[model samples]
Target: MSEDDRTRAMRSPGDGRPLPQRPADGLRSGGAPAHRMPGGGPGAPTHQLPNAAPQGPPESGPKPGGSRVYGRERSGSSPIKPLRSRREPSESGPPSPRGPGRRISGRTVLKIVAGVLVVLLVTVVGLFFWVNSRLAGIDGVLADYEGRPADTPGTNWLLVGSDSRKGLTAAQRKKLATGQAAGQRTDSMMLLHIPEGSDKPTLVSLPRDSAVTIPGKGRDKLNSAYALGGPKLLVRTVESVTGVYVDHYMEIGFAGFVDIVDAVGGVEINVRQAVDDPKAGLKLKKGTQVLSGSQALGYVRTRKGGALPDFERTKRQRQFLSAVVKKAASPGVLINPFTAIPLASSATAAVEVDSGTGAFDMLSLGLAMGDSPVTTVVPFGGNEAVPSGGTAVKWDRMKALALFDALKNDKPVPKDVIDAG
Candidate 1:
């Protein structure tokens, strides 16, 4: 084509529109060469070109249509704002409200419960040790002797209540009506037999004034053996007469008896008749009633109720002891910290056990006693006068032997022997 025709084709007809400028690199602003309109004449369709680049070095900014140009801004266009990432919260606005806290998993809850149980177990074990250490022990009280009875099928415990004012003050002694005695004497004695089989335990009361042959001394009142030689001779005398071995020995004095009863919050007893014994400091009406420590001590010590005072007293002793032990071992007291702690402290401190017996043995004793054992006094023939000892009760040899043999063989006592007692 002729140069004049090419030049005319690039320009617009008669209306005089401005011509597009070339960039510094000799190309159009869009980096493409200009193309001519298809029908090269006036009034024909033409391709529109972008505006020329601004003066000065090409702008490091957005182009005319608000499009980003190399991550820069243009003077007459709104700059393209970078997109906000999800991870980056907006700093210009107020803070968002907090949602609910994360929930704890079931596994975490189990772990917390297990931790609490471990703490409770540790605390219980510590308490057991502390209470066990408080039990009072007696040396050689159950020492083996050459002629001591052999081990029987059942466990035997010799429980002794002594008229000892060792720890009582003047006022206490006066209040308890326990005369000032120079030496300790037996107030009550009982043999508790716990069979290995499911049979219930048996508790037999031995009258203090019964005539029995002491080891070295001849025939005398049963309590005379204790006064002659301490617990050793007394154990020997009882064993020789009963022919049943004594496995454990426990003793409590008058003051200790009171403390134990009071510690357990008192014991309930059904009195058979009215009794007012000034000598024993006991006064009560007939019926069921709760007895405090001081009142319990007197109730068990009094020999003033039935025709046979000593027998009635023994019955009273057994009744009161069983009630108190049951209460002490009951869940209502054991599960309660207030009652359990004081009962443990007072009972352990007050009672004295043989060297071989531990806190567990004592606990077993309480549990066995609380089982409502068959209670009865030793079978007695009648009262008798001895040469050295004053008037004393005599045991019926035949019935007594049957009862002890039953205990030795771990068999139930003969019904006739139980009835005789």
Candidate 2:
């Protein structure tokens, strides 16, 4: 065949393109044969079209030492790069600069703390309202009368302990040795004076058997005022006698007294002497010890210890009351939920306060009593026989007047009168 005809026959039949000429060295760039010979032998020339793009250097192939370079290989067309994964960065370059991760600022932290405090404050406020609402109020106990004593410099509270069996069951009354009394009478009375200044408070006991003039009832034992006219008449009688205004009134019955004493666990008391009184249901040893509810009630009520039984009873009452107030206001009781809740419940349920008095006033009373108040009793002359009210104790007029005057003007009691009592 002619040379031109043989070359034409070497062209690709499908595209009618001429094949590439073998280089003179008879090898590819990497020293490998480009294609197979006509009979599938080595050392054949690679095919290429005349008008095709010029080939560049080999992008990947075997190297001089038989190690291969890994990359995109070139053809008559442009090189195609391998696809990269979205998660992985390119190994051919440094990773792109990234922004810092999110962080919490100081302001944000403060906002979180403030939110927590607000929630706690709301909870505390709600608890206060709930507890305050439980207080039982008595109406018109401190009503203004025509000749009532004028308001004094400091606060005065008329604290009355009544022998009312309103809440006590038969078994309880029997246990407490409280007879089946139909109507209630004042078992004990006290005037608690809280000075506005830094002076310590004063607690003065009013013996129930003392002779005092009850308005519209003439002269009789002081307790007869309460038995005849209840709280209103009793307050009037006390104010008229002492010349000191009564700002608040609180009364607790037998059952209430017991409940309160037990609620604070018990009250610590130092007994002056041993007493065994079956009538008052009190039998105690002399020493510093704690008294339970029933024992405390009897301890304060028994008139069997000193030569002047009633006088000694009044001292015991004052001593016990102050100790109880201190216990109720202690951190151990106020901060502990178990004791605090029960104490609050018992206290609020146990006492009847004037309409004007509230939980805050009671709190003030507790705080005042916890201050270790100076305790005394009305200076007395001697026992007397009253035609209408049996035997009654008589107060020393001059000394009693001086004591009440000091309290009315918010001045300290004269040391002579304090010692006299």
Please give, for residues 1-421, the per-residue lDDT of candidate 1 as tens digits: 9995676666645675634333323333334443446555543434434654322223354456654545544345655677888656567764444424346779999999999899878877777788678877778877888988898998999999989898899999999999888899899999999999999999999999999889889888999888999887888889999999999999889888888888878888888888899999999999999999999999999999688989888898988888988899888888788888888888887888877887778889989988999988899977888878579999999889999999999999988988888
TM-score each candidate: 0.74, 0.73
RMSD of each: 13.2, 10.8
Stretch of 10 with least lDDT, candidate 2: 65-74
For 1-421, candidate 2 gives per-residue lDDT tens digits of 9996886676646686655455533344434444434554333445444444433343455333343224423234443456777767666665555624346679999999999899878865765676679878889888887977789899999999999988889999999999897998999999999999999999999999999888999889999999899999999999999999999999999999999999999999999899899988989999999999999999999999788888899999999999999999998998677888888888888999898887788889999999999999999977788769478999999999999999999999999999988
In angstroms, give how far residue 308 of model 2 lies from its true place: 0.5
State the RMSD for candidate 2.
Answer: 10.8
